[model samples]
Target: MSLVKVESSEGITTITMARPEKRNALTQELCDGLYDAYRAFEAGDDQVAVLQADGPAFCVGADLMAPPAAMWKAVPHVSHALTKPVIAATQGWVIGGGICLVMTCDLMVSADTTKFMYPEAKVGVFGGLMPGIVSRMPHKVAMELLLLGEEISVKRAYDVGFVNKVVPLGEERAEARRMATVIAQSAPLVIRTLRDFANQTLPRGPAEIFVPERYKLETIANSADRKEGAAAFREKRPAQFKGR
Candidate 1:
């Protein structure tokens, strides 16, 4: 079964994370699924997208025990740039990379019961992908969550302009759909032009700016040639790289 579920109607596309059992943890397959879904959405006739997740939590970030091969792929504009806008509808806890995902979206709707947190500092690991949060919300507030690793309540998130709408616990997705429908009715060319212009005006973080470069390095780092090079260095011999 696919971890990501996609549905389209009335020029609106709904992309959902469907890993309720694990609170939609970003596994390798799930990341790939999300990338593929967004890429398809970009190419399809859909004019707007609503991103939501199944289960109590929107997402719990990476599965530390079995992290994705390329978590960045799941990020908007990083791997799959979309001309159309995406709105996130979140509930429960959104942490770490989950926060990254929501922050990248053009707009967001949070459940009244939701809590946003970035615990990478407490977990003793960091992805450095969340610096873009500073561009989305207040610099100091973003830093507080990034550095102190504390939870931000839904109300505070709204006050800080992180959330566009705050609905009841189970109404996040509905609100997102309503917003998406409105956007879908707008002129596509103008919407695309505005989205493109807005993206260009925003300051990109290192992760967003160098995603392609990082992808190349990641490819080389995971290649057999890298292992062979290391072995050859240790053995004082020339490396035999097949460019695999």
Candidate 2:
């Protein structure tokens, strides 16, 4: 059976990690499957994506027992380039590469029982994907997770702004899907435009912030979805955007 499952309905694509016996640990095949699944979602007509796992634990990190080369090649870094919104529904252990995966998502809904950790240091390895976590969190908090390699409670994760919402254990996936549905109802073109703009601007240093907002403005101004949105508001009806 496939380690990763991709299912689509309406405008949402759901990607599930399915390695429960091993706590959904990242194996070479699983990593490749995840990368391919994300790529498929990005290229497909899905306007939003929900990433979740089908086990007690979301992911326990990389399969350290696997060959080093396989492990290295299996990291799902492709998630970083997705243009559409990607929401993570996390529960139980989210460690090592699992933490990296959470950082890559546009939003994350973590279970109250979830425990985030970066135990790479404990295992004599450094988190190569620490940049992803550092980019999203404060420097001190990032250092704590990286240097100390301890488990972080879900409440602390939300407090530090790494997690968007903290839901009861079994409710995480439902809440994530609800959020994804809300996003899916929006104008797809505008959603992609906004995501693109944020991706381009938010990670850059002040000295590197040279891109002008006028480009996005022009794109929005010329989009049919924009005009439809205005018309719908004027008519007091919901906009029916065809992603034009």
Candidate 3:
């Protein structure tokens, strides 16, 4: 079964995280599913996307035992180039890498019950990509959340500019959809240009900068020419490279 569910109508695409049983954890399967969903949304006729999960919790971060091979693959902007904007509608707990995902979105609507936390310092595990949060909100506020490992209230998130809007529980999705509708009605070229400029203006962190480089290296590492070169070296023969 697919870990992600996509619904489109009237130029608005709803990309839902469907692993509610696991609190929408970022398992390898879920990450890949999200990656595919994002790519499809980028290529489809959808004018805007609302990212929400079908569960009490938006996400609890990575699965320690079976984490995604490339968590960046599921992250907006980091995973793929998207011309259309994504609005995150979150509820319950959004922790650690989950916060990383939300921070990248163009806008966010948080439920009243939503609690955003980055407990990486307490858990002794961090992917180091979250420092980019500084670009979105106040530096001191971002540092407080990242360094303290405490939960930030939805109100505080909104006040700090991390969250664009805060609505009552179960209303976040509706609010996000309304916002998406407005965006969908706007001029497409203007929207895309604004998003493109905003992305270019943001300062990328180590993880963001590394993901593309890693892809390049991995492509060469897994190429047929690489295998042939290794085999030729071991067999004491000339390599037949097809430039693949």
Candidate 4:
């Protein structure tokens, strides 16, 4: 099995795919490694988390050679189900399950040479998660990508608001980290609460999800960090937060 090599620095965590030989394809072992990493970041105070590919591609798709149908089930939900921020840094061909992985991330940065397509239609499989494609762009455009299974350009992805940024073919990971650093500079608690709010808000939310937001706000309000923030503002200095 390929290893999910990881590196962390300055409150930023980078999870890399060590299976470069297969273009970093997802396997059962990769899912286990990813779940472990996700659990670690969710439990800690990491400012940002990045998913990067080490090979010629971010992820080609699931390792078709892997065993157990249950493995495929666990593979699909890895991205969207994650609570913390995840940036999918794409480098090369992104196909099949790869599209779903990118869609699940909070932010996506693909290289100019990166190619995306859903070949499931031609291969006797259906489509995968398209992630607010209907809301982010015209239904016609979404349908074109879905039903036709055509590749979308990096520039086209940005215009539709799915991709956060695009960089040179080999510089995806660095660009993602640059975006993550800006996110990490903000208050941790605020970032979490806002992320939840942003995901589940108003029309389909607030109606059912208000209590959690209330709890989150109260936790922040009662935290020592909040008090320190006020104090720091009065003293004209940066707020020192201990993630309380």
Candidate 5:
């Protein structure tokens, strides 16, 4: 079976990591498939996308089952890999490569039975893509995750705000689908623009993000649909946005 399987229906694309026997561990094919999936999502008309895995494990991180070159190719230039919003549904062990994937996504949802860790140090290899974790999460939390490389539960992940939801085991995919469905029902461009805004702005402190935030706010606020949205809200009606 293909390491990565992508199915699009009703304007939602689900890119699933399909290797169950190996805990869906990253392999060369899987990395290639994921990279291709990202490009496809960027080009496709699908407005919402979900990155999930099948079987007990989400991903144990990048495929150690391949040549080092293959792993590096997938690792490089994927730091800010996505321009569109991507949701990650994680379960089981989300180690080295898996942590990188979750970091790249706009949102993450894990199963209550999920496990997360970064064991690269134990293996004597460097995990460079993990910087986003430090950037997004609190300092002490990121330190705890990396220093010990211990597996963390899904509830801990959600409490730390790393994941948006934590469902029962085997329900991560369903929860992600439900979220994607809700997002798909909204305006495509508007949602995407907001995603971009949040990613670009949220990382900055109030002082740091102020200027960029103002620019984005002005850009979106000046949009015709923004006016229509405001008018609709005041009128107690649904927003009929033309995405103008």
Candidate 6:
């Protein structure tokens, strides 16, 4: 049976980690399945994607018994490459790679009972996905997570802007789907363009923003959807965007 199960409908693709027997630990097969699922969403017609897990824990990080090479192959960073929005609905333990997965997503809706941690230091290895945490949060917070390897409360994650929302346990997926449905109602092309632009610009320093950034913005501004948006507003009607 597949470790990852993907279901798509109404422009949203839901990918679920399906290894509840082991608390959804990251194994080689599971990694490959997840990678494929994300890539499929990027290429498919889905306007949004949701990453969720089945069982008590979102993930327990890598299955230590799995081969190192296989573990490396399962990098969850691919989710960040998606132009469409990806939401993570997490609960229980979001540890190690689980935290990495949360960090990589465009948005996160975690359970109030969720606990995030990085236990790599305890295992005598650096967290390979530490960059994900550092990129999303302040250096001090990131360092603390990395060095201490202690569980970070959901409230703390929300306070740090790491999580977009915190819901009651078991409501995470439902809430995520609601958010996805709202986002899916918007013009797909505009959503993609906005996400692409933000991803490109948000991480850059003022000195780094230059001709390339301006050029991208100009391209989006001139897109057919942009014109349609303005015309629709003037007509006082919903715009029909074709993702141009």
List model 4 lDDT by residue over 145-168, tens digit each.
777888888788778776878889
Query: Taking the tens digit of each residue's C-alpha lDDT, what string does model 2 give over 1-244?
Result: 9999999998999999998999988877887788788778878999999989988899888888872333322333333246788999999999887876777678999989899888888888653545556668888898899889887899998998989999998999999999999999999889989988877665632211221243245568899999999999999999999776
User: For residues 109-150, what per-residue lDDT tens digits would candidate 6 score against the true structure?
Assistant: 999889988989899855344554666887789889988888
Which residue pairs in model 1 clash with each other? none
With a 3 Å backbone cut-off (N, CA, C), the pairs that clash in candidate 2 are none
Query: How many clashes does each candidate structure show, in the order listed?
Result: 0, 0, 0, 0, 4, 0
Structural similarity to truth (TM-score) of each candidate? 0.87, 0.79, 0.90, 0.73, 0.77, 0.79
Looking at candidate 4, what is the lDDT of residue 50?
Answer: 87
Clashes of 2: 0
Worst 10 residues of 6 by lDDT: 204-213
Q: How good is model 1 by TM-score?
A: 0.87
Off by over 4 Å in 4: 67-81, 126-138, 202-244
Tell me the lDDT of candidate 2.
0.79
User: Candidates 2 and 3: which is better by lDDT?
Assistant: 3
Per-residue lDDT of candidate 3, residues 1-244 (tens digit): 7899999998999999998988888988898888898989999998899999988999999988788778877788778778899999999999888988898899999999999899888978877678888888899988898899888999999998889988999899999999999999999999999999988988888888888678778879999999999999999999999999
lDDT of 1 at 173: 86
Q: What's the CA error at residue 215 for candidate 5, in Å?
A: 28
Candidate 1 vs candidate 2: which has greater lDDT?
1
Per-residue lDDT of 122-190 in model 1, one digit per residue for the tens? 988777689989888999999999999999999999999999999998889888999998899999999
CA lDDT of every candidate: 0.90, 0.79, 0.89, 0.68, 0.73, 0.80
In model 1, the runs with Cα more than 4 Å from the true position are 216-244
Q: State the number of backbone clashes in model 6.
A: 0
